[model samples]
Target: MPDFTTDHTEPAADRVERFQAAASTAFAPLLVRAHDGPPFHATIRAQATGGLLVSDIRTSPVTVNRPAGRISSSDNDVYKVALQLSGTMGVAQDGRREVMRPGDLAVYDTTRPYALEHFAAPDGEIRTVVIACPRHSFAAGPDALREVVATPVPATRGVTGLVAAFFTGLADELPNVDASGTHLADALVDLISLTFATPPRPDPSALTARMIAYCEANLSDPTLSPRTVARAHHISVRYAHRLFAETDRSLASWIRSRRLDRIRRDLENPLLAHRTVAAIAARWGLYDAPHVSRLFRATYGVSPTTYRRAHSGGF
Candidate 1:
């Protein structure tokens, strides 16, 4: 995150231009104005973590453009995960178009071109959150994930809903988070990975159920150590270890494996062209660059950068 200012008084054209200039280093920009209609207003707040960026945007009716030329020439691939808080909107991508209603989630890639047209309610308001990250961050193979890339992925239930909720909540809380907030970011990534990996289901075992739920709930608290979890459950640390041991895994091992899975998925995404392999790894909580490289190669049988380059068509 960086210092930012808000100006609601400027004319639409000037405001849009300013915003475009500010975001151009990170993304290709477009802002459209509504004419002969209700008042159109927009507020944008953007923050970055590694190559992943989260943007909270509320705007009035306007058309969004992702031109074909820009798509062909841009160095970085963009994925816009849009959550509609209110009103109705439409997105056109790769010759396919879909309209999104309230409580719906949709993803679109910038490597290819797309267009979005939004309509405000009669009361003249449209509110939404748009999280724009490098497409590779989502942790799915490009070919397997592309079919659903720009289409709406409903977050109305289960793991998807939980992950979506966590992201939206973080956007509202990021202003209050500081350097110590790294834990929160880590948890968000984990929850997102779990959400994308597992179908909606209840845990079958009590110990596993409790552990997973607690982990999801306290991902932001760095002090959420194994001791803390043991204490909360009225058990000893040894017992907690035994619980995981019964599953043939340790708590630390599970977490590390989960994090690695996320990194591998992002590395294979075709839409994350602009981000380097190291950047993607760090973004998902693999802090030691060399360690990440070695572990990724050992586990996946390919280096992180090489995997990303092969799948994403990156240079």
Candidate 2:
């Protein structure tokens, strides 16, 4: 892929204006204000890999803002995930704010008002790799996603750490890849989804959320019943059922539904075409072939075989 970069080493008087224009063009239409005084400096080196836009940015202290006027004129409706490589950045959106240090990650939507305050260290420059894509790129609800915007995702552990490492590796090797890099882009999106799919652990008393997290992690275990789930979380089976009383289904039903959904998705995945429907069902802990077929048909209004056929263009 070809690389695109902006050079801000022009006339010192107009460097700030030039940098602002370049920044807006590379990311989105927004206002960039120099943090302290004159002689603003910044650079944006970007590459388009498949459907993803990856950019490495190095800039002095500055605050980027997306105001209502700019949003009304052009709302891109895209999500920007930034991995702080050096220095710190403070992101504010949807009433949430987070200060992202080195190795920290943050996400924000471009359709609404937001601000990014980039702070440099003694080196006088902050570095980051920003990935931008349409909001629909991930299978998540807008409202539900908005709730987590501007929240800092620590890169020291768990899925976020893995994602941070992947981005760092990609940025390092991006100059060598000669193709579209679509597979890499897809993996990045998948990791982002996985990191966010797990509920945020704001407090320990979020037992229901903990249960959902545990269930999602162990969905492939056929023995992942309410008993196992409760035991894993150190709660009683009766209390586990009570925790889900307000939900539409019982704990067991919810797990089964999730497993079935995974199976249905696999059935439609072209990459999994070689696998049989029974095998896919078993992979998700639905070992009973007849029961899986019946439940799948009832949920999707089509048998697994028919669904795969339709998705694969074989019917």
Q: Which of the numbered candidates is closest to the native, going by highest lDDT?
A: 2
Steric clash count of candidate 2: 0
Q: Model 1 — which ten-residue stretch has the worst lDDT?
A: 195-204
Tell me the lDDT of model 1 at 148.
Answer: 52
Q: In candidate 2, how many Å is residue 290 off?
A: 75
Kindly state the number of residue pairs that clash in model 1: 0
On the 0 to 100 scale, the lDDT of residue 259 in model 2 is 99
User: Taking the tens digit of each residue's C-alpha lDDT, what string does model 1 give over 161-225?
Assistant: 87678668856865654444445555655555453442333443686679868865664353555
Cα-based TM-score, every candidate: 0.54, 0.60
Candidate 2: stretches off by over 4 Å: 1-13, 73-75, 198-315
Considering only N, C-alpha and C atoms within 3 Å, which residue pairs clash in candidate 2?
A: none
Segments in model 1 whose C-alpha atoms lie over 4 Å from true places: 1-9, 22-26, 31-35, 72-74, 178-315
Colliding pairs, model 1: none
On TM-score, the candidate that comes out on top is: 2
